[model samples]
Target chain A: MSLHAGQHPSTTAAPDATTGTRDWLIASAAAIVALIALYAVFFDNGSLIAATGSYLHEFAHDGRHLFGAPCH
Target chain B: MSIPVLPLLGRGLTAGGAAGLTAGLFSLLLAEPLMDRAIRLEEARSHEHADSGAAAVQHHEELFSRSTQHFGLVVTSLVFGLALGVLFAIGYALVHRRDPEAAPWPRALLFSGAAFLAVSLLPALRYPANPPGVGDGATVAERQGLWLAAVVIGVLGMVLVWQVYVRLAGRSAPVRQLAAAGTAVAVLAVLFALPGNPDEVPVAATLLWDFRVLSIASHALLWAVFGVVFGALGLRALGRTAAPAPSGAVPAG
Candidate 1:
C-alpha cells in the first residue's frame, strides 16, 4: 500500500509506549557515546587518555587546532 | 499530519555526510598541501633556532605518515559533517515546530547560514586558525579557555538575536529592518569586546596569511555545501509526507 493511502491510520494510531521507551533508551545511549567521543576529540588533553599516552592527542591534532582548541 | 522528526534527522545525517565528503575533498586538494608546506617551513625555522642556541622543540613520534594524515583528514571531515548535520536537523525541527505553513528549503538554508555564523565565524573572529607549530606550547590551556569562552558567548549572543528577530518578525518591514540592524550591531559589539588572541608562531607573514585564508575557505565550503545539500534532502523528505489541504475546504469545527 502507498504511504499516502496509509497515512490516516498511521497518524491516528497511538504510538506504542514500549517502542517509545526503547527508542529513547537507544537515543540516550548513542548520545552518551557521542559525548564521550566529543570529549576525546575536543578536550581530552592528557588526564582522560592518560593510559593511551597522547595517541588520542596526536590523532585529533589538526582538528583540535582547527577548532581553535589549544594544542602546542 | 505533522512532520515526523526522526526521518528528517536521518535525511539530514545522510546529506551532511555527503556534503562532508565534498568539503573534505576540497580541503585535501587545496588546503592540506598548503598546511603541509607550512609545517615544513615551521620545522626548518625550528631547526635554525636550535642552531642559534635556542632549545629545540620536542618532536613527537609520527603516528601516521603524511599520506595517512591526508586520508585521515577526509574521515575526520565526514564524521564532523555527520554530527553537524544531525544537530542542524534538530534545530530546524524545533524552529518550525509551531509553524505549519513553513517551507523546507529556505528554512534549512537560513538555519544553516545562522549555524555557520554561530559555530565557525563567531569564534574564529577572536582566534583565527593557525597552522601547526604556530602557537606557544605553554599557553595552550589559556588559549583553549579563551576560545571556548568566545564560542559560548557567540552562540548565546546568536540565540538572543534569533529571539529578537522572531519577536520582530510580525512587525512592519521598517521595524523588522531596524531590529535586524540592532541585532547585528549588538552581536558585533559583543564580538569586538572579546579579546583577540595574538599569534605566537614564528612563521612568515605570507605563510600565515595563506593558511588562515585556506582554512576559512574550507569551512565556508563545508557550510555552503551542507546548507544546499541538506536543504534539498529536507525538502524532499518533508514534501513527501506533507498532504495538501483540500481545495475550498470548510473548517471542521
Candidate 2:
C-alpha cells in the first residue's frame, strides 16, 4: 500500500510528519530497551541482578560465554 | 508502506524469540558438553597447583547446579532473542520506510545479514568467546569494556556504510559497490586500531579453538533463524495488507 493512500487529503502533510516523528520515537524506545536487555543477558555479572544473589549470573553464564560476552 | 509500529514490533519479538530458542537448544546440545569439560579441566589445573603448594585448595560452590544452569541457558537465550527481535523490527521499519519498493523478504534478509556482520561476526574476530575457566577474573571488566567498544564501533561502521550506500543512489551499481567496500575496509581499520583483549587463553589450543568456533556457530544460527523467520512473517504481512481497502476507508489505526 502507498504510504499516503488512506490519509484525508487536507491532513495528509500533517499526518506524514507526525508518523515520521512517531516512528523515530518508537525506534528510540526500542533501542534503549534492547540495550538494557543486552546488558542483562550479555554483561551482567551479579552487579545489576544482585538481588537474585548471582542466580542470574550463573544462569546466563553459559550464554555469556556462548555469545562472546566478556566473562571470567 | 508506513507499516504500523505495533505489528512490526510484534513480528520482531516473535522471530527473535524463535531464533533464540533454536540457538539456546543448539548450545545446550553441543556447547554444554564442551563447557563441562572446560570447567573440569579448570578444576584439575587448580588442584594440581594446590597439591604442589602449601596453601589448601578452596572449593567455590555453585549456587545453581548444572541442570538448573542448563535450564537457565534456554531461558536466557529466549530473553536475548526477544530483545534482538525488537531491534530487528525497528530496523525493518526503517528499511521499509526508506525503500518501500523492495520486496519485504529481501529487505528483511539484507538487514538481518548486515546486523549479523556488524554485531556478531566482527566483534568475535577481535575478542573471541572463551569458555569457563579460560579468562582471568581480574581482567573481565576491562575486557567487557573493550568488547562493548568494538560493538559500538561495528554498529557505527554499519551506519556509515548504509549512509554512503544510500547517498550514492544514482551512481553506477559497481561504483556504489566499491564505495561500500571501501567504507568496510575503513571500518575494519578502525576496529583493528582498538586495543586487543587483555587476558590470554589459559586452556589448550584445541579446546579454546573448539569453544570459540562453537560460540560463533551459535550466534550464526541465531541470526540465520531470525532473518528467515522475520522475512517470512514480513511476506505474510505484506500479502495480508496488499488487498485494496474500501474506498476512502480510514487506515487501520
Candidate 3:
C-alpha cells in the first residue's frame, strides 16, 4: 500500500493542500468529540445532566476509577 | 515519496486495535480482581457504619448481577482499547509526517512512550485513582477538576518538551539531552507546585494501598504492551512496502 513514509511519488512535491486540510479537519473533529466524551466521563457526573440524577456518574463509575478520575 | 495517508492511518488503527485488545484482556485478568476486592472491603465498612445507628444510604442500585458486571467490564475494556488505538494511529501519522526517515518500530516506541507519560503516568502521579468509597461525594466536582487540570498540564508539558527537543536536534547529543532534562524538570516542578486534592477515605490503609497499586500497575502494563506491540506492527508495515519513486525514475528491477 506504500504506507511507509517517503514511499509515495509525491514525497518530493510539496504537501498537497487539499489532503492536509482534510486530515486536519478530521483530526480536529475527532479530538473535539473525544474531549466532550472525556468531559462526560471525568467531570459531568450529575451536574451537567442533573435530570439523570447520578446515572452518568454510575455509568462512568468504574471508568472514572480506572482512569484515575477521583470519585467518592 | 510521501506515504499514502489513508493506508498509513489504517494500518496504525489496526495495530492499535490489536494492542488494545491484548491490554484489555490483561486488565480483565489482573486488575479486575483487585478492584473487586476493594469494592468488597468498602461494602463491609459501609455496613458497619450503618449499623452504628447512622442512616443507611444505598448509593445506587446494581444494574446487573456480579457476573454481568464482570462481563460488562470486559466489554468496556475492549471498547476503550479500540478508541485508544485509533488515537494512537492518528498520533503516529503526525509524528511520521515530521520525521519521514525515522525507522517505524523505534519511532512508534518513542511516540507511544511519550504518550503514556503525557497522557497517563504524569497525570496519575498528581491525581491517583481511588477505589470505591474513597474521597467525599460532595467534592466530586472539585476532584474531577483537579484531575483534568493535571492531564491538560501534562499534555502541554510534553508538547513543550518535544518542541525543545526539536529545536536542539542539530546540537550535540549531550546538549540535547541536557536541554530536554531541564525542560522536563521545569514541567515537573510546575505540576507538583499546583495545589493538591487530598481525599478522606473510610477504608483500611492496606485495602486502599492495594487498590492504588493495582490501579497504577494495570495502566502501566497496558501502556507497555501498547508500545511494544504497535512498534512491532508498524515495523512490519514499513518493511512490507517500498516508498514510491519520483516520476521518470527507472524501476530498480
Candidate 4:
C-alpha cells in the first residue's frame, strides 16, 4: 500500500490536535512578541488601556497608509 | 537611540514582543511543514524529468505563506509577550504584597521593554518623524522614490547574501527570514521621518500609535532575535535532514 491513502488523505489521529496545540503555543508566543513591540512603542504611556486604545485607532484606521502603499 | 531600559532586565519589551521573539525564534526552532511538503512535491515532479514551473512556483507560494505566517507569528508574539510580562509582575506583586521582600522583578519589564524599544528606535531614530507618504513630509513623491530606491538597494544587497545562506540551508527554510534583519535599521529611520511633521498627522496610521518613548528597544531586539534564531535553526535543520534516496530506488505509482 502507498504511504498516502486515496485522494481523501489517510488521516492520522491525535497528532493533528497536538500540532494544532503546538500552533497555538506558537501563536501564544507570537502574541507575547507583539506585546513586547507594543511596550517598546508605548513605554512612556505605561497605561496599557490608553496605549491599546490608541493602537486600535491606528490599526483600524491608518496602518497601511502609514506603513507603506498597499502591495496592490 | 537606545531605549532607556527593559531588555536589560525583562524578558522582552511587550507581551507581543516576547511572543514575536518567541515566534521568530521558534519559527527558527521548528521545522516548516509547509516548506517540507513543497520540497517533496518538487522532488516528485522533477523526478519525472519534467519542467513544471507551475509546481515550482506553487511550492514557492507555499514557502511564502510559511514565511509570512512566520512573520505574523513574530508580530503577534511580540504583542502577547509584553502583556504577559506586565500581567505576571502585577499579579506576582499583588499576591506577595504582604511580603515586600518579594517585589517580583521590577527590572524585568524595563530591560525587556528597553531592548524592544532599542530595536525599533535605533533603526528609525535618525529618520524624520514625517516623511514620504505623509502630507507636507520632507520627501515629495519623486524624492521618496529616491530614498525608497536607496533602501531597496541596501536591502536587496543583504537579501542576496541571505539567499546564499538559505540555499546552503535545507529547502524547508522560510522566506522573509532575511527581510526582518535586513530592513531593520533602515525601516526605523524611515518610520521616524514619517511622523514628526504635523502635516504627517495621518502618518499615525502607519505606526503602532501607542507612541510611547520605549518602542525603540522592542523593534531592535525583535530583529536581533530574528537574525540569531534564523541562523541557528537554518543550520540545525540542514544538519539533521537525510539526503533523499537516489533516483530509481523507489518506483512511482
TM-score of the A-chain for all models? 0.74, 0.70, 0.67, 0.41
Quote the RMSD, in angstroms, for model 2: 5.1
Tell me the tens digit of each residue's lDDT in model 4 across A1-72. 233334221122122555645544444564565455543332212235664543432221111121221110
Candidate 1 residue lDDT tens string, B1-253: 2434465566567877887788778878977777688778878887988999999885545776778767766776776677777666656655665542245567667777888888788788777888877777677677777777877777777787778766886799888778877987888787778766755667788877877777677677778888888777756654555555322322110
Go through the candidates in order and give each one's DockQ. 0.34, 0.47, 0.32, 0.03
Candidate structures ordered by DockQ, highest first: 2, 1, 3, 4
Pick the winner on DockQ between candidates 3 and 4.
3
Per-model TM values vs. the true structure: 0.84, 0.86, 0.81, 0.25
- lDDT for each residue of candidate 2 in A1-72, tens digit (9 for 90 to 100): 455667442221134656857766786788798879888888887788568766677788888888899876
Write candidate 1's Cα lDDT for A1-72 as tens digits: 234654752341135666545544544454465556656766666667568876676776666655556666
Tens-digit lDDT track of model 4 for B107-210: 23333333333433332343322211233323333434443443344344344444454454544345444544455545445544543322324333323233
> What TM-score does candidate 4 get on C-alpha atoms?
0.25
Pull out the clashing pairs in model 3.
Answer: A7-B243, A7-B244, A8-B1, A11-B1, A11-B2
Which model, 1 or 2, shows the larger lDDT? 2
TM-score order, best first, reads 2, 1, 3, 4
Q: How does chain B score by TM in each prediction?
A: 0.87, 0.90, 0.84, 0.25
RMSD for each model, in Å, please? 4.7, 5.1, 5.6, 25.1
- Chain B TM, cand. 3: 0.84
Could you tell me which 10 consecutive residues in candidate 3 chain B have the lowest summed lDDT? B244-253
Residue B100, candidate 3: how far off, in angstroms?
Answer: 4.5
What is candidate 4's CAPRI-style docking category based on DockQ? incorrect
lDDT score for candidate 4 against the true structure: 0.35
lDDT of 2 at A25: 78
